[model samples]
Target: MDEDTPRLLADTNPLPETIDARLAQQLTFLIEIDRLKTVLRQSPLAAADRRENDAEHSWHLGLMVAILAEYADENVDIGHTIELVLIHDLVEIYAGDTPLYDAGKGLDQREREAAAAGTLFGLLPADQAARFRALWDEFEARQTPEARFAKAVDRLQPLLLNWMARGGTWRTPGVTADDIRARKAVIGDASAALWAAGQELIDEGERRGWSRPGSASIT
Candidate 1:
């Protein structure tokens, strides 16, 4: 189910009889975010034949942070960075996945996602809601070392998927190798080491015809 907007629906099961009000609010938010699993992305699963969902993408980022922390330019708190990646895209439950190569949609991407953050995070108890919203804001700001690394991992993961899937979104018409670099190069913000490797991967993708060639009008 490719849901564009998150449905505001109640779960089939009733809340537990002994649950406190705060717990119920928290549980409601948890249940609501289950929709994230249904929101499909553009990147194909390297092992599977279908596109992975938002929840899967976040989980992959957590693991990637663990595996690749050593390569970050700064000595980051790995756990905090993992939290940023995991929390970063929960707003997509409402906003939906914006494809990296989709330039037109990217124009309003921040506004769409900020509204989503407001609606989704507001589901939690007031205090928790504020905290989660702050975390999401932090991820978006990319000011701290952890946020920068998290963003890098976020971009780097999709690049790996596209390469593994033999030009996944790179195969999209009009999305040239330069287009790939222009977007994915944000990886350099956190890790010059990773970006160096990623640039080679992009170049190879173009050389092998995995990515489209020529400056086609993407906008």
Candidate 2:
């Protein structure tokens, strides 16, 4: 099923005690995550009227894992990397989407998202919640190869979208090449080839006068 589609809730019809507990909890968690589709991101959809949502972003990142896994500096478990990207943005449902260039907007981002992760993942069964939360934390820590690759793709996706839209988000008044580089440093750390690809896009944006040099923050 598409990750964004809402599943039938177990509570919609009263369940007998015989219903499997794990299955019921999993279904509930799935239904809740469907809210991710409503959490619109700052990045606009390419050639579309609307913005991309957390669910679509996660799905795209999952596809990137399959397509770009070869570029990772160290061998990574594709399945684990997919899992990490799939849930990385679930917290955005509660914390809300923070634009890549809007550094001042999410001043308490870590604390807010950490609490959001706890609540969202906690909806799953005990073991599954713990495991999924661990994956989210791993992605945040960026220590393991899987986490690093996942983060690289996470950064790469927005850059691709902005380039496609001819500087969609990058056109924000104060956004600059330096802001892109600062936010996208992880791409180089995990995959030099992918980083080069991203830089090529940025260079083209600059050449076309779609992106300009400026500081993201004045203070």
Clashing pairs in 2: none
Best by TM-score: 1
Error of 2 at 183 (Å): 1.2
TM-score of 1: 0.93
RMSD of 2: 4.5
Give the per-residue lDDT digits (tens) of candidate 2, residues 3-57. 4423435457655777698887887778777788999998878768778989999
Please, what is the TM-score per model? 0.93, 0.90
lDDT of 1 by residue, 160-217 (tens): 9999998998988777888888888789999999999999999999999998777645
Model 1 scores worst on lDDT over the 10 consecutive residues at 1-10
Query: What clash count does candidate 1 reach?
Result: 0
| Deviation of model 1 at 213, angstroms | 3.0
Best by lDDT: 1
Clashing pairs in 1: none
